[model samples]
Target: MRAHHLAAAVLVAALWGFNFVAIDVGLDSLPPLLFVALRFVLAALPVAVLAPVYGPPAPWRYIAAIGLSMGFLQFGVLFVGMDVGVPGGLASLVLQTQAFFTAIFGFLVFGERPRPRQIAGMAVAFTGIALLGLDLESIAATALGLTLVVAAAAGWAVSNLLMKAARPRNTLHLMCWISLIAPVPLLALSAAVDGPAAMATALRGVTLETLGILVYVALFTTLVGFGIWAYLLRVYTAATVAPFSLLVPVFGMSFSALLLDEPFTALKLAAAVLVIVGLALNIGLVPGRIVPQRSART
Candidate 1:
């Protein structure tokens, strides 16, 4: 990869990392489900406005599947997990488990076998999760928040498989169309789960800070970040693009500590190291003879 492209990849990672903080702040004002709904509503706007210029990137079914899994399930669970108490930094690290989940789902759904190193990587990463679970500092970093974040990772894994299957030429276009499919269902779910009164109350209470958070997540984090990511993926090999994502958790932890005043406990630091090492191994970043027959895109 060229220097500028590498910079672009890192920039995306930074944006996505800081996104957790944005979501954390947004959750203070809006219920998780409702916040997700509004984010998607704004995210889908480009698709609606640009319909005449750039139509759907794939079949509606594929777009819908990606939408439900990626936009709805993943963010829905993630925001709820963070809202419940999981710190933004921890959520970022935990979400990296999606790589392992993607490998598992790929094996089951598409008969893609994970190499020995990949299997070993999963074990190491799960050990980090176990360590994370043992931290009894509060409920936020323990069972409930951890489990929900892990579940969101699974949803993200499912979306990865769906996107791989779809094989759209333009990832940004596909994403925009996927955004279009999420809002209505998410709104319905928000109403059912959070109740209409809560939604109304939250909407009535939206401040400029809340609006800025929404714009950041919807425009910068979702759209601009992914737009650059898609460009990088096109220019470089997935291997090159994939490792930069590892920087996300590093940035997440740092930004959370600085911006949100979240502590970096000893256990959290240890877990972060283990998870990042596992991810490196999983992606073949750790040099070794054991190589997979095929590279799995997380």
Candidate 2:
């Protein structure tokens, strides 16, 4: 990766890390569903308005799947999970399980085998989760939160697979479609689950702090951050892009401590380390000797 791309990766990581804090703050003023709806709505506008400049318009099918799967289900359930009392730090950690699930999904659905190092990584990851599971307070709070977040993660993984399977030429075009189509479901769901009163309630006493959080999440995290990511992925191999994502959890933990006043528990620290190690292993950090097969005698 070039220095600028490296900087972009770190920038994306930091912005995404701070997203947990933003989500926590935003939930204070708005229902999760409503907040999520508003978020994608903001995200969609620029791409929709500048469609000609960005790329060709997306088909409805592509738009809807990316929208519902990636935009709505992913962020919607995540917001709900976090709002329901998932600790920001733990929520950040748990969400990384998406990579594990994605690997599993790839193997099961697409018949790709996990590399040997990946198998070892899974073992390390299991140990990390075991450490987390032993924590009483974190476990209790995280049970429901983790469930919902995991659901979102699965949705995200599915979306990723679909994006690859579809192989759209333009990343921005796909994202535009996702952004455009996502808000409708989010709005409908938010209205159904949270009701009109939730919107009214959130709007009535919203402070500058809350609005700042919303703007930050909408612009920085969803729009600018993802835009850069898609650009990098377009420019490089997915493997190159994927490895930097491990930095996300590192940033997440540090930002959580700064923003949410979350503690750096030994368990959390250990879990973070294991998660990073597992990601590295999964992506083949260890060198393997290349063995050549001998030619068969006739």
Candidate 3:
């Protein structure tokens, strides 16, 4: 990748990193699923305006599946897990499990095999999760929150598979379409689980702070952050672009510690290192850098 492209990737990483903090803040105002629902509502706006002019209708069935898995399930569980007092830093770290889940699901569904290094990396990552699990009771959220985050990662992996299956030409467009599909179902689920009374009370109590969080998450993180990511993936090899995404948790943990006053303990640091290393390996990258010929655009 060129210098400018690398810069864009870094920017995206930073925005996505801060996204955890935004979501954490938003949870103070909205219920988990309601917050997720609002985020998607804003996310779907561009599609509502642009789809008519830019293209035919989006792939509805596929986008709906993507929404169910990635938008509703992933974000819903993640919000809940974080709301239960999982520190944004650790939540960011644990969510890297999505890469492993993607690889496993890819193999099971499509017979795509991982290279030996990828397999080793996954084992190492699992070991890291095990290490964190040993200290599960030490964290404020406990094991349930951690488990929910892992389940959220699995939901992301499922979305990855759906995206792969759909083979959409423009991932950003797919994302916009999914945002449209996700919000209503998520809101419905939220009301069902949270109850009509609590939902009404929460909605009435929404403040500018909550709205600010929604705007940050939906516009900056989901839209612009992913807009840059899609651009990078299109212009560069996945190997080159993927590592930049790994920087997200580094920034996430740092910002969480600095801004939220969250503790960064030694054992947690070790676990973060393991997961980041595994993430690097899973992306098929080494420190020396391997730049492949850019493949034709999908």
In the range 99-136, model 3's lDDT, one tens digit per residue, is 99999999999999998989989998888877887876
lDDT of 2 at 39: 80
Candidate 3 pairs with clashing backbones? none
Clash totals, every prediction: 0, 0, 0
Give all candidates' CA lDDT scores: 0.87, 0.76, 0.85
**Candidate 1 per-residue lDDT over residues 85-152, each given as its tens digit:** 69998999999999999999999999999999999999999998889888648424657777899999
RMSD of each: 3.3, 5.7, 1.8
Shift in Å, residue 160, candidate 3: 0.5
Error of 2 at 218 (Å): 1.8
- The segments of candidate 1 whose C-alpha lies over 4 angstroms from its true place after superposition are 138-140, 287-298
Off by over 4 Å in 3: 55-58, 289-298
Error of 3 at 40 (Å): 0.4
Candidate with the greatest TM-score versus the true structure: 3
Report the C-alpha lDDT of model 2 over 1-298, residue by residue, as the tens digit. Answer: 6788889988998898888888877888888888887787777777756776756455567667777887666888888988886776677777877777778889988998988888888778757766776773744456677678767777778887777676776766566567777778877887898887877878787889888887898889877888899887767766667777887878887887887788888777888788778877887654354222222221
lDDT, model 3, position 4: 81
Best candidate, lDDT:
1
